[model samples]
Target: MTLFTELRRRKVFRVAAAYAVMAWLLLQVADILLDNFGAPEWVFKSFTVLLVLGFLPAVILAWVFDLTPGGLQRTPDAAPAETGVTADSGMAGREQLTNRVILVGALLIIVVMATERIWFAGRGNALDLPAAAPAAGLAEPDGPPAAADPARSIAVLAFEDLSPEGDQAYFAEGISEELLNLLARSEGFRVAARTSSFKFKGSDADIGEIGQALNVETVLEGSVRKAGDQVRITAQLIEVDSGFHIWSDTYDRRLENIFSVQDEIASAIVRALQLELDVGVETAGRTENVAAYDLYLRGRQLGREPSRAGLLRAIEHFEEALTLDPRFAAAYSGIAEAWVWLEDYGGVPSTEAYPKAEQAARRAIALDPQSAEAHAAMAFVRQRYYNDAVGAARSFERTLELNPNYVTAYNNYGDVLRDMGNLERMIEVHRKAVELDPLSVFMRTRLASKYIDVIRFDAARELLDEVLAEYPDNDYAKEELANLAVAQGRLADAIPEYRLVHFSRPGDPFSAAMIAIVATRLDDRALAGAWIEAARQQGENNRWELLARRPLVERDGDWAAMAELGRVTPGPEGALLRGTAAARAGDWLEARRLLLEALQLDGYDATQPARLSHMRTLTELAWVEQQLGLEDWEDRAAVVEAVVEELRRQGAGSIDENGVSPDYVMARLAAMRGDRAGTLAGLQAVWDARFLSHWFLATDPVLTPWREDPEFIALAEQVRAHAASERAKLAGLEVLP
Candidate 1:
């Protein structure tokens, strides 16, 4: 008589239940498949919307129709006839069987859905998984583990700040980071670095998901409640696979005993993991003054924000911490780290910031000789500011030895390897850095750039595209994409990307300068002139301005202007370019002196934007050496032989470690050696690679002897034609506003 009874009699409830289970199952499978296949989010949303819309229709159809023993039939408004008839018994039996089947099917669907969720939770998006470990020697035993070891590998998530005001977040993070550092220093276990672990700070993802994402077996998480001078810290070490607590403890301590509490927590965690602490490894905090430590923690929290005001504020906090306890080595290290970022984020010149960073790093190291942060800071300064690769390498080695979980050290060390021209080693270290911090977009993009350096364009593009999909407006990734375009001779394509970058950062000298350079390559004089002026105004005579101007000078065959640009370019790249121009102007002795100066100032690999390859410098020097009949010509020739063999080993037309087209370098080397067959082979390879730099090809002194050759002239014409085609495309494109 009731509506509910009527619905039940028609089996609408059963149909609804079955439909719900089926819909849920479909959604689960769809989500997993779509995510794995890199489907657009809207596709999944539309699928869900369609399934929801179909639910009511399915129930309505069930209410209206029913399956009898012989065929489909309309459901009766009243209950089935209860009279003593054979048909009634058959109907009851059939109804019971249908109910049982529907119940069992729903259970199975639920089980299947749950299992899929569990499986996919353990394995995240399939496409995002990191590649396999590189060659054996690539990952050092001391670095973060490449694979999870249940007994040792762990991630220390950022601690929750449960203070009344919820303002002790920095204090809580400091405590968690201290535990992470202490665990990292202990032998026989792997600790995920802070960058990866803290990524799940406020995440709703469960333990298993975090573990799989971080590639760890266990996770350490806790909460901190601070009330004035007293603090209550609760810590628990959980087995990520099982979500079981391996060790848990609560500490109630005064502010002065915070260091002791950290040590106690570290000891308990180490004991629970059955690992012994290594002697001589650095312990918890470097200072006993809690006030100073609080300031240091605040400084560190702000330093993570990569902006000028935040970094400057971070420095102030660090300085205040130092004033509280002048002997706090960690605070000094924090200052050094802040200074390292000031050049990029705070717009401080490297000439001004690096010296201050070195001073702070030296002070930190002096106070605490075992300070890994101090060593890493010193290493970065040595690499970037002094161009002392050997010194930088030594410091980075010491840093990793002290704290092998240092992701930044690995990344910078990778750069050092790049500058040292050890392509394999550079790639290996970059892989290690990514292994340690899988969630870091910075690390991923840097590795992509390294792949670009070696002409691994597809791999680089894949990584960049993956990053862009997740972070659509990531300028760093976009910049690397532009770099890839340039490397592949897609100069016209690069201009739009550079325009996007410039739009994002309107006054960025590097992006503006890059736009100018690409515009010059495309022979768009109007675009080139506009961006060049923009770059000079914004660059304030920085290295980017120098690099951007060189292309214009080369386009005009102004060797004097090139030499003048080089005189003020500042780094080894300046000396190298100046030497090349000097050689072009018939001053072989001056060229030799400047070329040797370049060799003394920096390693063989050239920095980007300069577009001065080590091979270019070597070829120029070779010419100069022969022209002057220098005594070191034989040694130079031997070096040239080794370089030539190295280039050949990289495969023809590859981009070498310095981001130079190996084809271009090889062609220059062959021409310098006066081997006509090698020269032709190299030129053909260059043409195959489409390295159509018309100005460089036309005016390159190394290619002067080949100018009269028929094949060389043909290749030159091909380059000019390609350039003209690209120029037309550029002319048609709307200029950037």
Candidate 2:
């Protein structure tokens, strides 16, 4: 017999074919599962290696064995002439088995392919929203009626790095971000924020689902391959709902032509979306120096991470870029952004960093006056470091005018408005931010916090719950929920949530301090002490303030420590803390003097009246004036009353129309008037609202008159009972000692 006939007779060919089909299916399933689970590439490689290694054994087994009616048997050694009826019968049965195996394998292959298609057809396995309908107010961008809106929106997903070394991911990311920035600057084009757009990097999500999540009509995705000075970039813009390619291109060019490549990509997108480019609409790239541009891109990529180390690394790259090309406006803006973050994150004092940031930003504007990034950086410095509300507002407005779709400008402007006591306008700006970057966790969280600030608890809760569901481990979301619990008088409920935040982000002293503060309210002294120490040790910028407060909260009479804190701490915030310590020690005159000094500081007066520091200073000043029985007591009271009225008029208060709750302020005001009934009413309101700071309530001298009141005592006990009940609910969760 011929060798081919012999192989077929032995079922080796059928075995190989069946194995090949099964192996392909197995690899496909493995690839999908590994990618979904975020497994390492080696896992798939090993699986493929094992499959290849097993192929020879499988073929050898097939060649050595034969099928019969009863079971497998060795192939007969008999020659062709000597073969009997039994051999012929065995051959027929073997053929039947081969056909059955091939048929079943084919069906399985079809099933696997269908399953993959169905599973990934929508948002893939990452999200579990309904498949049929788009999110509220967002329609599919198929054409016609939906297209009549005329506003073209797009999200630029991070480009895949196709370089041979696989080390060019940052370059690919920078290119995608640059394209996004370019599109955002284009008028009438609404672009998703980088945080939201890049969240889908390496995801197998459908274009339609990504569009729905981001509330956009189109998505741009691409790959970048760099080899020496030559680069190839392939990009495609797809209409999300129809999955139609609106525009597609591949650019093969030298590194120096990178700016042109970006310009071409932006022009293609604008053309595809049918957006009208205004006269003198500037191209995105600001620098032609390839080396400087590369460094700038790296800096921009690193700056996205809002951590101290990340900011410092970004600063290094930005500085290097400037050294290569001193006129690079974007690079200067990058340096300013990193420095601002360094201060914001407490990596450096505001005094040291803000000046440098301001200088860098000014340099950027000097180089390119129309640079929105430079304007945005200047705005952040003015608002956060300088507390210059007017200057910040102007810069922010100018930034928005330069880049209408700049989401960060809207977010920062909302914050500035909030500080200025414009609650309605703050909410309006935040809503706009959400509209622009619908899928951003940071933006959503910011909006939710604003809702909480306005006492719109239900709305805030809905947003927070949605964020937690999408990102179960999000510390910011968890922290906000804890704050909400505190506001609602669920002290026990807030404790574990705060603990989770502290546990997850141990480097964040604020979380640790919050845990300690909440624990004091719950009368969990040991827990309070533990977290207080944790805060003191881990706290960077605000360590002394936290340490000083601990002695007062515990009533440990550690005046020497407070004195030392005053010596070390600088700025108005430190002055406020020292004043607080003096007030705690019954040194009213000293407290008043320190507080007045704080109010006169550059940081204090520049801050808005709505700020916590301003409110605390005013409240303390009022209390001191009442204690001194001065003729100006009424004047101080009038000032406090006017501020409260203004806050109310601005819609800036809480459930009691004064923010968080006005009960504490009302209680203080009533105490100043010796109105026992009014004081009790305010205290009751505070308790009912669940602003349970037991330590503060018990120790505050301003509330001394009500301390002996029977009704007040009863209310305090009720608050304790509520806290205990909430604690009981956390049976299995970790709790502070």
Candidate 3:
């Protein structure tokens, strides 16, 4: 008799019950993992189908292996030994066919999965939200700064976990990072980067020392520890410059005290910072289970770098926790977080994975209404999808309210602010991020570089001094500082900085570009040509990739090079370079065409507001119009009018030919059109608004036409004197007699 028939006759349902239980347990774990880590519904659905398919074989295996009354069956040929050879011969043919069918089916499944994975390799394995959230007008905190003021700077130092024996090391570290991460969700604090904190990993540096190093006023530190089913935590706040530990705390609770810990720690830090929160602050989704929280932490530690293998491993650990406790909210959030990284950098396309990513984000949010992670995930989706700035700003704000010292939130906040032309404030935000993460080389260099963009050279120099003093080998900082030197027309001074940076990074584009510009200025044609060639080979240019193109493009004879540059580079400037090249080649039509296309691509971001909206976009637009043979005063005035009318519709005003600010661009546009009064009006408005020179107008190619006109030249002199007067007013500078 067959082994299956024998087991059925012997009432072997008991073993079948055990198999079912095992399968059910595995299913439960799979369900939780799929929700958290984010995979297509088919993955889990297929599990059920597989389980059903495997049932007969599983029963057969169990029955064959079971110690039944009749004894174990070695194979399907369970006939007596005497008849075994003949019986086996008859059954082998059919058994071989069945086995071949099973093998082929399994192979097909493997092939399908492998093909799907390969097809979507570029997009990554995790899902992402298509865009950030719709920007709701979250009521502003009282007396929000109108712009990124230099005086307003904040930093968050890494919190120390002070548990006995460091038993709560992961918990303390996770909580601190999470809380800071949550706070970073907003554009409120100019928070520091995480790498900045690495140097203090084990140091008990006093707040005063840290403050001097990071240049910030507040520091937060905390710890976590657990004993059996109970947990304990201690938190403290210190005023950085004062070296005063203003507050301290200790808490004891059951194992399921995760929510309480997060809340207490966050509330303490917020109160210590003396900051207000949006209504959304109270929306942080709370979870109480410590076991699940621990597993979530384990997963997060893996995902911090955002790698594919790391994320898959994290998903496995999260699965283990879910096996023990199925309804784990934090675990789901961790899974969603992994998926986002996977989609962002893990080479997984949104088309295939976003549905999974969305499900996890939704699940986490549904489970915990106050999840900053959930909100942030949604915000990322919105950014990618709709390019909705207003919505991203609100979501980011809510994220900060939920956690007040998040560095990432601060970084993203600066991004949105920069989009609005708040360069000074963007510099401040990056400064805050560097302070929070004092050991972060990238943040410090980036912050210092931003200061240079807005002509805050003194601030940039000061920051670079700090970086060079501590880590002289940092190439990005050294090279960027060289770029700053080049801006000041100090070719001699800039040479050393470029050489130092090039020595370290070898073929770094920023160094190459700067070297090329400075070399050409110094009359070293060989070095300049060498740099030009190297920059092209090194490959750089993006929002983050400032291809040293700026200095080269500004130099004469490089217009031809710009066409080459445009061909290789990406984004707005690529188009701008092509247009500029066409113009220099005497093809104004082509130049105008390309520039107009760039204007369309940039849309709202191309406009400058502080100058009242007459910035590069309008200037370029005006240039195109003028070159197209509409150079008369009446035609110029008409161009300004069209731009002004558009700005007015957007609740903004015009600036000048150059949209340094809306008002300024409009005024310049009006003046270029022969409206002397309009020119002065725009100039006066920008002056009053405290828009600094050394960055805009004078060197800006936008106002080339106006710079040649005598009437415009007279207005420019008046503005320079007026700016000096305004500086004196703001800072009480003395007018030397």
Candidate of highest lDDT: 1
Candidate 2 versus truth, CA RMSD in Å, comes to: 14.7
Residues 149-239, candidate 1, lDDT per residue (tens digit)?
2266889999999899999998999999988987787655778878889999998999999999989988989888899998877776777
Q: Using TM-score as the measure, which candidate wins?
A: 1
Worst 10 residues of 2 by lDDT: 126-135
Q: What local distance difference test score does each model get?
A: 0.75, 0.73, 0.56
Ordered from best to worst lDDT, the candidate numbers read: 1, 2, 3
Model 2, 272-388: lDDT tens digits are 465665312465338779899899888888888766677788999999988888889999999888887766453365567888999999999998998999999999888866666
Write down the TM-score for model 3: 0.47
- CA RMSD per model (angstroms): 16.3, 14.7, 24.6
Clashes of each: 0, 4, 73
Model 1 ranges with Cα > 4 A deviation: 1-150, 278-281, 344-347, 503-508, 532-539, 603-614, 631-634, 647-659, 730-737
Cα lDDT over the full model 3: 0.56
lDDT of 2 at 695: 50
Q: What ranges in model 2 sit over 4 Å off?
A: 1-151, 241-244, 271-285, 343-356, 543-570, 581-593, 602-613, 626-631, 646-661, 719-737
